[model samples]
Target: MTKYFRSNVDAMASYIPGEQPQHGTQIVKLNSNENPYPPSPAALAVLKNIDGEWLRRYPEPFGGEFRQAASKVLGVPSDWIVVGNGSDELLGLIVRACVEPGKKVVYPMPTYVLYRTLAEMQAAEIVEIPYSEDYSLPLEELVAVDGSVTFIASPNSPSGHLVTTNELRKLASQLSGVLVIDEAYIDFTEENALVLVEEYENVIIIRTLSKGYSLAGLRLGFGVANPKLLQGLFKVKDSYNIDAIACAIGTAAITDQVYKNACVAKIKASRNQLATDLKQLGFHVWDSQTNFLLVHPPQKKAEYLYQKLKEGGILIRYFKQPGLDDKLRISVGTDEQNQTLVKALSSLL
Candidate 1:
């Protein structure tokens, strides 16, 4: 730790993101919950057509182009949207804007680990409410905390289970502070709590193009909230957080509804099939609305399977945390890649 660094910054642990292997095209990667499909054709077309002169000037400070596109598609006003470099950036912005030192930031544990890191960075009090034994939301416990900011991930990471809208509405109504719903994987599910924003002034729902839109490489995310709440977020955000090319491509991707829907449909189908296949192999697989399966392997330990699969040129996510040690989170890949994973597991087990 540096002598000049703030004590909070020196003491806090950084968030660890999913690994992006450097190996070229040989490994079947199911580690990150990235879309296995390509991005919309329209987005690619926009990227190819971007002029060099446009790159010379600074991009729009608020990502107007992408905001307009998102508004048109999501049925929200432009002023209600705030774009970010990624959802992670927006998450940090929320913590900075709402949570003060000695104030509380609450989130469910065994969810996104970043929530804890974000709270720690701000020197805020952390209230981590553990999920139920089956990995469902502990709604009553969360509401009682009444933090300065509360984060909830629907179709949560690693587990892939969803919390219902009524449940979230109940929690929101009871809380005194901001309720930020991180809907990064909501595209894969049937329910979205977007309407809650209209009903509750304290509610903010954030979405990312990284999952269903297959634009992880572009790093675009946006939040929809009451216009007044969005104005507060705008103050905390970087002056030019999103670049010109990202705005152009994000606009194109949002406008291409047909292509995006097709890709999501294929992924949903694959997710269902993958779960069924793993269950048939004697693994206890949870029902997932997201593009991943959390499975408990029948014979070998979860860590053993994780390492063995890595050696066999297939990669999946296995968290070393307490509750998650027994399960492996596998992103739903293309049929060929998934089949190869199953074959590898079958051979090893």
Candidate 2:
């Protein structure tokens, strides 16, 4: 594999995503944090009404339509946005633009593991600081590294905790390099770091429609920052990164905020109820600000339960790594789906 590739490419492991079992009515998927609800009617309408001829031509180079729609929703100017195939692609773009071989990329762990994979792809040195006891931002520790870029996934995955806005602002002020705030799950949380964009020129906030808007298949995500900071991204991004279909559907979906909000409200309610049920079963569940719960099962049966659930046509995330080997991440599913998961776990107990 490495004979024709860079030495670093041969040494890195690819990022493993949650499983998507395509053919099973019996399967209740709670592994990936996908919106259990459907996409906005307005977006579906756009998908239905797209003129075939429009796609025959090249798409607008920078996702003009989506930028304007998200701008209106976010109350920011359109130029301040940079759209990506997914927030994942935008994350890669930032890494490519900022990190050189042997440069440092920092974040608190355990986090979105993609950051580590992205750094490995670039042969960049990675600095992973442990989260504070309460999962607050390790501000002083992060600032000391002075890395080329820092990535913070708010309402962090597998932990479901968010860094305080004030702490992020302070870190942004203290850092000598870029601060990328990954807000993929922010819709489920009470607060966010969007305001930091206007406050600090060095900050970039990444978001996705995959979680709250129910548009994961569309692969649409965007980054928010001061326009000055977006120049390098523009220079490195593919000429036609966003397609006409995504632009149209994304515009309709983002513009239909009422529909998106209703769905988010349901997921949040379910998250609360699910946490309560798991606690009753003796699992140590974290207070989540996202559409999932990070639970440590009683009797150290986390791994065993994960296997038994899968055999019962249920799927949840199980990480076999240090610090998280004993935990499971359960995505908030519909009430019926969650009941199936709980029953399976209970039967194993």
Candidate 3:
């Protein structure tokens, strides 16, 4: 088996996801930044009443209906978007299509570990630039690396800080290859780099229904870029990448902007409150634009709090890597759920 695998596949470290319990609803699930609210009623309606006969036919290639639904919302034409199983898949597609072995792949350090993993899969040269102490983009260093694909995760995970659009435009202009901005958590934030897509032909923005629309279980996401850039991805993607069920339900979800906005508003409110609660408990909380907060606990108790919270039936993210070993990333839950977490922390600390 060892001899059969590519050396890159054999040597690369696998991406470790947050813990997923057997009974998700049975516990306070906050380790993963999933939507706390139920899906849009319109989407649920489609889910419950999808025509069984449509399963017999292959799904419309490239999520035809969803592209149209998301078009009106994104203000992009259907052809400008390419649907995928999730933003993650589209990312892989980009790497596969662009990166030849030893070609460079660059991203900011401690932003998203998946960028490193994806680069390794391609056996590409990985260049990671460290963010400033305030988590500001190190634009000069990032642009210096001429990578085949450069990733920036806005409202970035683990830190929950957004790179400014002006900074992104600057980086995109200097980079020789595609600039992939992963905005999986953009719904919680007010400003985004969607405008950059229009200004830069090299830009591709990756978004998911998982966070904003309460569709984590559905695994549907899409990338918005110039049609010229997306044509290569379309050629490399699975013949029928999107399923008929997802097309129907995701269409319903994206169309109901009111419900999605309401859910995002609640999460943003909870995120603010949770940040305040952590600060009161002697944790240094960062100003966050995403639905999660990155906080440094008092007395270097990051691992202690992670274990104690789990023992109390609550889950939050703790990273053991350098620069993040002393911090924890908490996903915003329902008000009641967050109250339970804070009460537990108050008792433990």
RMSD of each: 1.2, 1.1, 1.0
> Please, what are the lDDT tens digits per residue for candidate 1 over residues 232-264?
888989899999999999999989989988988
Better of 1 and 2 by lDDT: 2
Q: Cα deviation in Å at residue 114, candidate 2?
A: 0.3
- Per-residue lDDT tens digits for candidate 2, residues 1-349, read 2398788998988899999898647689899899999999999998888898987899999999999999999999999999999999999999999999999999999899999999999999999999865787888899999799999999899899988899899999999889999999999998999999999999999999999999998999999999999999999999999999998999999999999999999999999999999999999998899989999999999899999888888899999999899999999999988888888788888
Tens digits of per-residue lDDT, candidate 3, 1-349, equal 3497799989988899999999645789899999999999999999889897989998899899999999999998899999999888999999999999999999988888888898999899999988877998988888778688999999798788988899999999998899999999999887899998888999999999999999998999999999999989988999998999988999999999999999999998888888888899999999999888899999999999999999879999999988999999998999999999999999998
Residue pairs that clash (backbone atoms under 3 angstroms), model 3: none
What's the distance in Å from true for residue 168, model 1?
A: 0.7
* Every candidate's lDDT: 0.91, 0.93, 0.91
Segments of candidate 3 deviating more than 4 angstroms: none
Superposed by TM-score, candidate 2 places the C-alpha of residue 75 at a distance from the truth, in angstroms, of 0.5
- What TM-score do all the candidates reach, one by one? 0.98, 0.98, 0.98
